[model samples]
Target: MFFTNPLDNKLRKWGKAKQELPASVSAMKEKVLASVKPKAEPLPKTKNRTPYWFVLSGALAALVLFIGQYTLRQINTPVADSGFGIASQEQMALSSKYEEENLASDMVTPNVTPSDLGIQYGEATGLGGRSYEDSMVEKVSNFISTGQDRNGAISDAREFLKYDYSATIKTRKVEQISSRVQTIVRGHGGRVDNMYVQEKHGYVYFVVPKSSLEAFKNEIKGLVNVRFYTESVRAQNLLPEKVIIEKSTETAKESLASLEGELAILTKEHNTRISDLQKQLNGVVASINRLRNEVTTSTVRQEEIKRDISRLSAVQQKLQRQITDENQNYNSQKFYLDDRIKNAKSEISNLAEQDQNLQDNVETVQGSVEVEWVSIFEIIKLYVPYYWAWVLSFCAIALAVNYFSKRRTIEAL
Candidate 1:
């Protein structure tokens, strides 16, 4: 198709008006045309192969996000120790003792009948029809069996065995899980002893009824994934220590009773001695008064009576001094008794506290739960392994849009 220039139309209109250009104008037009050579073709736009800084920035951001997510996830991973504070060696030994006792109970053979042993009753040189060792083993087995069967309930072994439970969880909703843990504990008629909640982590220590521990554990399981959860149950046999405490407490009580009895006896003796001394002193005073009266009324034996008065007066002073000394001695004895009594009472109180602690351990199950917070990015990475691919795709699209937009703008200009 042929195209007409707009300048051509204007020139035709000028010519139809019969307008004649001067020679100088014609010459100038020729010069102008010569000067205005055909517009140099725009240098072909070289393909802009510049690196997309924005895309690179996006990639760097994605890498940083990946690293951060990985770090967060690692932080949430449960430690090998489960972070449940370590138990003492003694406690660990006691825990192992329970297991050993259970195994021994299972291995224990039933008492061999006297008839099976071809020994009649009372023929084994004992009141019972069994050997002493067999009898002792039977009793121990029964005790062990009773302990295991109680399942942390009230029983003979309850006073001697302590139970504890610990668990840890990792989740994105740390605060929510912490609350749920407390709710579960309370629902089981348990009480929270300690709790710490924060944006990224939480800890809850609780004591639940031993009878409800299993149920509480079940509820805790619901709040965590198996992969992100850890748990431990420990049973420590406090029998030996408890027996020692009991013996000490009994001894202390006996000592206290003995001290009280001594104090009572000392008080009675002190009162009786003081009364006797006062009576003798009163008699001496009466005698001295009588002697003085005689000296005044009877002139014949006045000198003898005076001597008798003097002797009575001496006795009176001696009695008074003896009473004073007796009082001091009694006070010293009383102070000694009081100190002894105080010490005994204090010892008893301490032992009682220890016994009470043991009882509480047996009656309740201590539990702890640690909640580790997870970031949203970490959660996404956890659920989607190829999250970085999505980031890369986004960057690629942005780069393409930016490049095409610049191309369009340049073509328009």
Candidate 2:
């Protein structure tokens, strides 16, 4: 093809511009230029370089977000047995058993409160207080309240305590018997609880401390010729009922303690203020006594009044009889005299009624000196005749005789 001058000039201008390209341009591009020159635009790079801090910040932000998301999802998630499962997790769970939370102990684990559990947890197990029963009653109560049934235990205890101890020795004086008993008891570390020495009969009662009961009994067998031994000691686990009753009694004692305090205050006041009142009362009492002296014996004030009324009636009748028998001017005089006697007796009777009421008031107040006693009676063995007593005695005697005969008869022979 023929090249025009203008086209040749344009080509030379483009070649100079390409010649300005970097020397690193390859021989390959030169060969491509020889084959067919192509027109194409090259992409440009930023004149300013990117900063290291921006790239580092973007990477750090992405890492932090990934960690936060992982942590959020982990919360409230069920425990698993992965690398981060419960086995590897640094956590422990508390026991959730209701018994462990409530019972507070493993032994005698209470299943329910006493109200729901019946008598075991009832108010009967409450604290104790004082009582008005005598010492004997108090001791028995204490023994039973731990767990023993009341009536049954007391009956059992009484049966065990009953020992018809009847032994007659050659000792002339009561002192010798007492001395011998003391020596035997003390030697075995036992002590006598009670002894009675009277004009008619002497008796001794002692307790061998429970720990020594068996030992003491055994020693006694070797020491004495046990004529009649009917004492028993039994172990008993008292029921809760006794303890409940005892505790109730203790509460009663607490109440009584408050009452006794009030009584003490009253007594003090009586000593101070009521003492003066007592003087007035004593004067009233003295007047009452003097009036009572005016009355007859074998009668209360009411009875006295009746007796005097009868006597007055009898005397008046006799006087009337005498006057009627005389039957003279005495009949006119009798009317005046009989009327006077009737009026005097009527006044005395009215006075007696007043004195009776006063005596009653005094008697009503007299209970301050009176004490209350629970009536206890000896149960007479009425069903058993003297023959039974003799049998019991003869049995005891025969045993003693047989033992003595075997032991002593040989010596005598």
Candidate 3:
């Protein structure tokens, strides 16, 4: 290698000197090339097994890649609701509950009730109460942080909103971070609604008091490295729904009150009618007693009085039957009306409960957190400039390729 130095040729060319080698050096070069070109004792012919070797190597590489990919997928897949790092009861229940509730809230059902009565609220409508006014207010709010005073402009003071926060963090301690998040949430007067954890990743959903949302956010920010943190906030205005709910509640209450009033009036009328019938019955009894008490000297007159008494007794029996029938009918009607009143009261109660839930949503904020395990290499990458890393990697690969090519060339010679 020292005999054929590349730098010697370049230096000779630059100095404008002769480039040809001496006769002795040329002869030596020829001898070396000739010796390497021929093998001793005429080597036996070998079969061309290179293709088979290449095929085998390719198959092995493919199998290795496939197994690696499958193992990675298995590692990344989330476990069941009751699996590691999960709040079993809370997570399972909330997962199904919130998914259904969200779907229901997104659907819009037309006002099936009479338009004159306004929009209907309850499970019948799937809980959608987004109106044109609501849309306008939402759009306007998106442009302005606060509202302005005007004759008919809506006020933000009573605007109800449901807050949702989401964040993704990369850290080595996924389970530890998940547990810490749960603790922090609880400490902030919140509860974890759902969670899932794996060796390398985790997820958690929680709700905290809106009054403590800022504090909760700051604490969460400190849990993991801020450089690997990604987050977003979303809010849904529920003022229009609240208005509709209030109206529905009021309507239900009025209906209940009306039914109660009708019940009272029916009771009073029923009593009055029964009282009148009883008085008439008493009068009939008095006449029969008086007729019986009277002294009759003639036999014909006594017989006539007895006949009149018998007729009055028959009339009294008919009146008693009429009173009995009237009482039975009154009881049936009162029962039917009372049932209706009961139903109305139940509907009102349900609406009131829904309203209270809405209030609670406004008082609290929902949050979702995702944690991922970041390896040491990834941590180093965060501080290293991306372009510089790529350049260095390319240089290393080029050097390896050049080294392999030179080795193969020398063996061929």
Candidate 4:
């Protein structure tokens, strides 16, 4: 028999095998080579070129157009026109008119003019209604100094008023006293030009005629308790002083006019500012309304979102409950299945053990049966030779018994 070495045969087979590239690899190599090779066709070239001057001209034109448009826009821009100037002018006119009316209404015409006070183009008088010359002569005669003359005394006396009286009365019943004083002043053809009445005290400013002043004082003295009183009498002309006062009054009136004009201007400015502020307030109100609407919309959306969230939360809670129930059921089923599996495994193990035991018993019984069969075969083989001998003996005994029986039967017959 030929025995070839396996290692040598394998080496020979490996050496005889042909080394060749796959068809797909060869085809891919050919494709790569074809792609790497340069093509024979020539690339096309443009014949025309745009001039730099044309590009530059287009850019310049665009810039000019942009500048022109910008200039147009600047020229077309509207100048804002505000009504504040006009409104302020109108308000100033109104304020000036109102101030003039108020000034006219508030000004009180004087009842006692400079002439009534013996201060204007009049002869000076004494407290007793004496003429200025007579009063001066009497005063010079009574109390003239050594160097002073009658004319000098008279001039000195004429520079001051002859009499000016003011008094304050105190009383427990101010209201009643004030009323009586008013009545007496009125009855005496005098006027209570100014009066202040309070719970504890009263002030009565009586403007009595020069002739009735003494009578008015006496009447008031009878009506109320007099806390203090004074009377003054001095010669006065007051003409030059009145002239200075009139000049000062004129200056004050001029200042008041200037102040009124300035006040009108200020009021006009204030009204203009108020108008602007009113416009701003109206815009603010509009914005507030818009914001309020937005807030209302947001509130509605918020409510809707809240309801949606609530519904989603409820759904989530329900789903969570279902998941919990499912998890519980799954756990219960898992436990039941686990127990069933364990029981099945235990039963299978027990069955396997029983089956092994049965197999062992069957093997033991088969071995015993085989041993018994072999012993039975041996016994049968051992009895096989004696079986014929025993049969022969049985046949001899049967023949002898048959002969004897036949002989006996014959004898009996």
For this target, which candidate reaches the highest lDDT against the unseen true structure? 1
- The TM-scores, one per candidate, come to 0.49, 0.19, 0.56, 0.20
Candidate lDDT scores, in order, read 0.77, 0.45, 0.75, 0.50
What lDDT does candidate 2 reach at residue 345? 53
Instruction: Residues 66-138, candidate 3: write the lDDT tens digits.
Output: 9997875544333332233222234434444555456444433322233323233323464334764444334
Full ranking by TM-score: 3, 1, 4, 2
Evaluated at residue 32, the lDDT of candidate 3 is 81
- Runs of candidate 4 exceeding 4 Å displacement: 1-162, 225-239, 242-413
* Tens digit of per-residue lDDT, candidate 1, span 1-413: 12565878877987888777776998898888899768787999889775899789989999999999787555443333454332333544454555557644543443455565534544565554256656544545565565544333345453455787887787888999999999999999999999999998899999999888888898898887665665767776766557668778999999999999999999999999999999999999988877766525556688788788888888899999999999999999999999999999999999999989888778888889988876666557656667889999999999999999999999999
lDDT of 4 by residue, 80-126 (tens): 11311112224334544554455433332223345544444333543
Worst 10 residues of 2 by lDDT: 365-374
Identify the runs in model 1 with alpha carbons over 4 angstroms from their true place: 1-158, 169-178, 191-203, 224-230, 295-298, 371-413
Clashing pairs counted in every model: 0, 5, 0, 4
Better of 3 and 4 by lDDT: 3
Candidate 2, 1-413: lDDT as tens digits: 43556887888988998776556679868877899857677768669766899889999999999998787445424232132212112221221122233323421232333344333432364422244353333444444353234334444442212111212221224454545555556665655666665432355565444444446556544433332111222232222223344445555455545555654554464355535544554554555455556745655766865665566556555555544444443444455545554554555455555545533332221100000111112012222335457778999999999999898878888
